[model samples]
Target: MTHPPTTAIRHSPDLEGELRAASKVTLIGMVLDAVLGIIKVIGGVFFHSQALLVDGIHSFSDVASDLVVLGVMRVSRQKPDQNHPYGHQRIETIGTMVLGSILIAVGAALAWDNILRLIQGGADQVPGWPVLVAAAASVIGKEWIYRYTRRVGQAIRSDLIIANAWHSRTDAFSSVIVLVSTLGAMGGFIWIDTLAAVVIAGIIIHIGWKFTWDAVKELVDTGLSPEDTEMLKAIARDTEGVRNVHELRSRRMGHDILLDIHLVVRPEISVSEGHQIGMQVVSGMRDALDNIRDINFHIDAENDEEHPPTSEQLPSREGIRNLLDEHLGGLPSHTRIRLHYLRNKIHVELFFESPDDAPGLDAEQITRHLQGYPWFGSLRLWFGAR
Candidate 1:
């Protein structure tokens, strides 16, 4: 038997608040990136600092990425619809990948331009002191934005936002490189500025690759870590009435985890008891892991993982009742009948209101006759109040 999954499409209570937080931070970063991008680019051209020029382009890339983050946050927070029952969380993953791609392209183009200039003889003149001031301002501003964005991302448990936060940090790091290279140029080594631009490009490409790969893993439905999977299994096994746990699977949907497991219980337990055990397991898992969004569980009379499933041709309840009637010369009226299908056979239990109802039913004779059937396992009879 399988417990139906809980209503899986409902939105979290704090989704609106999370969206607002994400949007507010992203907009703030965008404004900063635009202002810095303009300042560093114009300053690089007038002051003759190639490193500053590249850092300016990197800031513009941040502006574009911030825009992507804003759009994705809005779409990813949307409620699950009829066509997409799992909600739009994967949209955030796609958006992150796109942002990474943008970084890669921008970094590669800038790096290639600087390398060409270096090959053909570096910059004609040393950069002016104003480039130092622009780079310094970028370092301070980008660092502040990085800290702010990271705080919001952690609060919301958003991977996309955190990845964007690191993107901002990278900008700050690149600006630091610009400052060092500008100093070296002013001290009579102009080659350092062009070389620093190459180094900054490499940093951007490395971060871009990490973000892209992480998103790809999520999109492909990667399972949780081995430690986490084992912890979940331990919780299921600890629940009372559970004989064993198997087939525990998990995947991520944005910041939430989706899980399903198979639970084994005593073969004779009532269906209600089995269902209750499944519920307990679900509750236990949720208590231990806050990110679990949904769990689907299957209740088993026997461990299907260790034993072959009962054949489809095995008699169902109606068929078994009919067979019993034919072989027993009409079964006595019973208050309830329970059937346990396990290990490729059926065990039957019948409860009668009183002994008189069964008349002279011979247990040995009935057993002898039913044992001839391929699916027969065992039988038990109960009389009096059941």
Candidate 2:
């Protein structure tokens, strides 16, 4: 009934702006990649170097991938409507997978072609100092492009941009091999060009496989690193209004994070008080990370201890409701509350105005004053409570 995702905090305006800028940067790279690809393709066709031609094809694929990123970004920005509830964040990840898959395919093709040529004992020789110079210039340019793109992607936490940046890096490395092969062909060693081509293929294949692995894992709903999960869980547990946390799942969508956490509070907690606590947890999580955008905290009451003594007191519904009223006394009457039982766990839900409103704070100094009460299991938060 509930699932928590590998979620991150909402991004700041600067972060959002940064991501948008990243998309723009991708378009720029796409243009550059396209131009370079065309040039290399023509040069390779005339000079007859399979390595340069393959590199050109790789660049062409990058242009296509950049287009995918642009499309995904545009769609992802559209506000969620009736057709989609969780927002369109995953579309960005889809872009990354598309790009990664393309890279891998290009790499495999290059590798296959080289293997075939080597087996046939035949390879073309493209002679001239101009080709080598051009390749060296391309290598330098591409490497710089890689660094620029990579820095922006990391700063903005954009997986698509990061993937695209690495694509440039592969291109740069591939060009280096191209340079070597060009020089080797002129040095009277024909096999050197073939060997360099093979190396270039190997490099491309490695980049493709690595990029694909990251993209595919996210597409499949894999959790975040164990360390990050533990840290997030700890933050939720220690935050006010969350008695216990469960069903905590975290998953990545490109550079973004989505989270769903079940929060536990005392069963007697009022709608206002539980909502307050949920808000606190959300704030805590938001404060903990810079990338989190949404928090879905499901507030519920903690169940009573197992094997309760016959003489021990059990909270009455009226008493629980009274406690909730006392905690959330200032809230408007329109607030709604829900009750649920899961695996014998008792929980009470309270709809509050906003998590930021601390109604009972006129009486307490600490953040978590009543999370230990027995009437609730957890408290979770969601924006625009209905």
Top candidate when judged by lDDT against the true structure: 1
Poorest 10 consecutive residues by lDDT, candidate 2: 303-312
Q: Could you report the Cα RMSD, in angstroms, for every candidate shown?
A: 2.7, 10.9
lDDT of each: 0.82, 0.68
What are the TM-scores, per candidate, against the unseen true structure? 0.90, 0.70
lDDT of 1 by residue, 254-326 (tens): 7788887888778776667777888888888888888888787887766767889768788888998888888
Q: Report the C-alpha displacement of residue 119, candidate 1, in angstroms.
A: 4.3
Supply candidate 2's per-residue lDDT for 308. Answer: 32
Superposed model 1: Cα runs more than 4 Å off:
1-13, 114-121, 332-334
lDDT of 2: 0.68
